[model samples]
Target chain A: MTLTTTLIAGLVLGGTYALVAMGLTLQYGIARIMNLAYGDMIITAAFAAFVVQALPSMNPLTGLAIVVPGGFIFGYLVYVFLLSPLVKRAPDKATLEVDSILTTFGLLFVIQGVLLVLFGSNYTSYTFLNVPVSIFGTTVAANRLIALVLALTIGLMFYALLTRTRWGTALRAVAVSPQSAKLVGINTDRAAAVAFAMGTALAAAGGTVISMYQTFTATGGVVFTMKALIVVIMGGVGNLLGALTAGLVLGIVETTVSTYLDPGLTLAATYTIFLAVLLWRPEGLFGRRV
Target chain B: MLTLDALSVRYGKHIALDNVHLRVDPGETVVILGANGAGKSSLLKAISGLVTPEPGVSITLDGHELAGVAPHRIPDEGIALVPEGRGIFTALTVDENLALGAYSRRARAGEARQRDFIFDLFPRLAERRKQIAGTMSGGEQQMVAIGRALMSNPRLLMLDEPSLGLAPVVVGELFDALGRIGASGVALLLVEQNVTISLELAARGYLLEVGRVVGEGSAAELKEDPAVRQAFLGLNA
Candidate 1:
């Protein structure tokens, strides 16, 4: 029974991680932007969901209809107005990586500042569907179960879209080789913009679902960002299936550690795995060696 | 028809192409022959908008000025380039690479027909459509590149060193495929190091020496020229 409870909890956490990391992969892998502001975007979406929930007869899930598209538009505008100039000025990918890191680092602080001013940096959460339900002889919170289902559904949908559609294939082509993408008549800049937007949309969806089950503060975005980044690296940068599998592994490890040993050692366990992976397989678990 | 006038490309202080003028009419095959550093690649790059030519240069294809067009837009303008190193999406499958080749608006109408034609031209590609392109042999990768370019339904196809690192037998098979593509009414602008097979494939030829066109003639004239025989064909004058 205890094992089942831990596994279920871990899966819920892993689902959120997988969804968020998928977005980061798209931004970094396809758009070539090491977006330091990614977590802040999630926090912003969480806040948006919070506000929507405050309205009469509304919930976080309903907020997704607005927040997801809102995130996409915001991502598009950010890429065009903030990042495209850097892309144009940078002579190569290495230069662009450095430039985007510096730029989005500044953007991180700016977004955090705005969220703090707006929400006052206090841990904020709302109650909606906090009822518990039994699953295979273990009781779990209904909202968390909903979040898990949503995350898995959306993540798998994105995976299918990437593998099955022409536009998605073009995006993957750009991720694989931007120079070759142009030879096939794909406007790489446009593809990058779309990819960045899609990434933020995923982020927004993850955040909204997370808001349904977790406490989030205006300044708490960095923690989510770091977790997603770890998942992405563990899975192999730009490898979607890798990210999904790594996220579940990390979640299960953290939960198993917390349940079996000391709860405070969960973070330590996460770092131990991260360091081990980095030392042994720097290309990531699934990534091909460069 | 394609025409280039006074096209010059500079790489920092180095001149890769110097006021080079060239032409290729519709359904024609022209080859540029030059030793290393003779600016053959630069000329093709300029035509495909991969590199910018100097101001006042003119590159027109079928009455469309393409000198300053964006590289991505060049494909929509009915030009395709199989760059050095094949430039195929190595991570993608052969089928995906060909699918992307028909991404341009002009190629959408005839995508199925073009794929059929490419498979007929290089049956190896049809056999390995599901294989990842990078894992393929050099000859097969070059076929994917050429097939992908053909998927664009290009009026003028430009190739830069398509046979750079292939085996001798593979090079022969590759040129045979190129001959079939040329015979199918697509204009080819080729830069080749192999003078013998290129002379046999091309109708006209130009000799580029140090970024300038030093000689231009029919393939027969170039093959018979004593300088060409000595410099390219490796025969005593």
Candidate 2:
């Protein structure tokens, strides 16, 4: 019964991780940016939800009405104003990689600082759904189940868009080879901007879901970004389905390790798994090791 | 018609094309023959807007200047380049590659007809439509490249060394396809080291040596010129 409960917890955690990791994959794989600022976008959304929840008789989910489109436009502006110019002027591929990392790293701190200034470094959350529901002889948090369901639904929607839409086809092609994409008459800048918007919008949605269950601080962005990056690397750089599966696997491992061993060692276990995967399967579980 | 007036390109200090002038009228096939390092590829790159030409170099397609236009915009203006080594999106399926080729609004409008025409022209592509482009043989990839360019409904089709790494039989078939493309009223600008096949397909030709145009004439005149025979035809003149 304990194992069943743990597994349920793992599944919920996995869903959240999948949501976050998908966003990182889009930013890194499609836009070709490491996007250290990715978690900052999440933090921003979390704060936005917190503010909305603090308002009289307001639901934090309503924050999505603001964060989703706001995050996309913010990301689009960042790509258009900050990243694209650097990409355009980059002398070579290696330079673009390094420059993007450094630039996003700088942006990460700027966003974190702005959030700290505005929100005063408080650990806050929205406590709307704390009810427990029984499932197969174990009780699971209803809020967590809701998060998992929402995540899975959104993931499916995202997958359909990627596989079934013309924009999705163009995005995939641009992700693989921008030069070929351009030759095929794709406006690569617009493709990249859209990639950034989609990625950041997903980040915002994931953060909103997270705010419902966890007390999060401004500095929480770093740890979240690191975890999402691990999931992305373990899955495959550009494979979304790989990210979903990898996220589930990670959540299970983390939960199991915390349940069996010391809770403090969970972070260590996560790093160990990452290192093992890197040594054994550097191309990731779903990627063809190039 | 496509015209290049005093077109020049440079990579830092290394000059690739120097004050070269060339033109191709509608439905005409023009070939540029040159030795290795003779700026042949650079000439194509300049016209395709892949590289920015030096100041005062003017490229016009149907009297519209294309010198500073972005590479993606060139295809929209009815020009397509089958780059050297066949720049097919290797990971994409053959069908996806062709679909992407018809990406411009004008091309998209007629994509179905163009796709049918391509399938008729290269039946192998139709058969392997679902196959990944990278897994195909080199000659087949060349066909995909040519077919992809055709899908764009280009008024000017530029080819850079289409015969490279191809078997003689495949090369013959490729040139035959080029001949058919030229006969279909699309202007052809071919840059090749294969003088014999190119001369056979092209109506007119130019010899580029060290970034400069050294000779220009009808294909028949170039085939018999002592300099062309000595340098390109492997004949003692």
Candidate 3:
């Protein structure tokens, strides 16, 4: 009974982790950039939420409402301002990816440092609304449940965006062949900027939702980032369905370990599972690992 | 009509094209022939705005002078290149690949017409519309490339080695399709290494040697040139 409960709880939490990984997968998949700052950018989003909480006019969730779209715009600017300049000099995929990783790492360090300086080091927790609901004989946290719903919804929306819409088609075309897309009059630079922004915005949204459920610090992004990379690799780069299944798998595993052993061992178990999955079947659950 | 007046391109100190000049009047077919390092691909790239030429070396499309226009605007200028190596969006499905070709606002306006035209032109594309382009045969992908270019409704179409590495039968079919396209009034600029076939298919042709126009004439005139026959057509010099 305890195991089942743990599994259920873990699955819900895993849904949130999937949300975190979506952005990572998107940027990596389309642009072929690692997006190292994606995790830290979430930390930036969390801080943005904290600022909203401190304000008299808003709560944390409302702050997220304001910040989510803004985060996308901000992310777009980051790609345009920071990443675009480097892309010009890079002619191949490997070099562009390396440059993106280095640049994102620099960006992540700067963002985390700024937050630490402004907010101090103590962990902060806040909830816009906390309402519990019973589901299939189990009590589910409203925020986790909400995160699960929003994560899946956004993930699906993201998939639809890439596949169905004209803008999505243009983006996918750019991802596949920038030269051909341009020859047909698709603005590849604009497409790259948009994809980068959208991916980063999801990172912000993930941070906003996850922060509401638990305490967070200036340093939580790296952890979240690692978890996201695991999910992305497991799911497959640029593969939406792959991320979802991988997210659920990671969730179930973490919850099961926490239930059976010590909470301290959860990280180890997660890593163990990640390595095992990686070694046994590198393509992840549904995605091709490479 | 499109004209390149002394267009020159360089990679560092190395010259890719050296003050090369050519002209393609509206509703005409012209072929550029060359060896491996003969700057044939660079010429197409320059005209498409993928590479910039030195100052005073100009590309004029209907006399607008496309000196620094970006790649996205090239199609809007009534010019589209079916680039060498069949640059199809392999990860996308066939329909998605064709749909993306309608990126220009003008192209988008008559998308249905373009789609219908493509379906008629390449029936195989319509049959495998949902399949990923990467999974298709080489000849089929080339058809998709040409069909995608046509969706933009370009007045001037440039094909860079459309027959590269394909079987002779596939090349024959492609040229036959090209003849149909030429008859439809779209000016064609063909870059090819297959000297005899290109000249045979084209109304007029330019033979390029290290980025310079070494020979230019009507197909029949060039075919009769003793020097041309030896150098390009594998006849005795």
Q: Write the per-residue lDDT of candidate 3 for residues B70-99, one digit (tens) a residue.
A: 989999988889999989988778888788
Looking at model 2 chain B, which ten-residue stretch has the lowest summed lDDT? Answer: B88-97
lDDT ranking from best to worst? 1, 2, 3
- State interface RMSD in Å for all models: 2.4, 2.5, 2.7
Error of 3 at B45 (Å): 0.4
How much is A236 displaced in model 3, in angstroms?
Answer: 2.3
Q: Which stretches in model 2 have alpha-carbon errors above 4 Å?
A: A53-62, A288-290
Q: Candidate 2, clashing residue pairs?
A: none
True contacts kept of each: 0.81, 0.52, 0.88
Give a tens-digit lDDT track for model 1, residues A151-215: 99989999889878888999999998888898888999999999999999999998998899999
lDDT of each: 0.92, 0.87, 0.83
Runs with alpha carbons beyond 4 Å of true place in candidate 1: A288-290
Best by DockQ: 1
Q: Highest lDDT among the candidates is held by which one?
A: 1
Cα RMSDs of all predictions?
A: 1.4, 2.1, 2.3
Worst 10 residues of 1 chain A by lDDT: A281-290
Tell me which of candidates 1 and 3 scores higher on DockQ.
1
| Candidate 2 lDDT for residue B208 | 95
Candidate 2 lDDT, A95-137, residue by residue in tens: 9889999999999999999988988787877686789898889
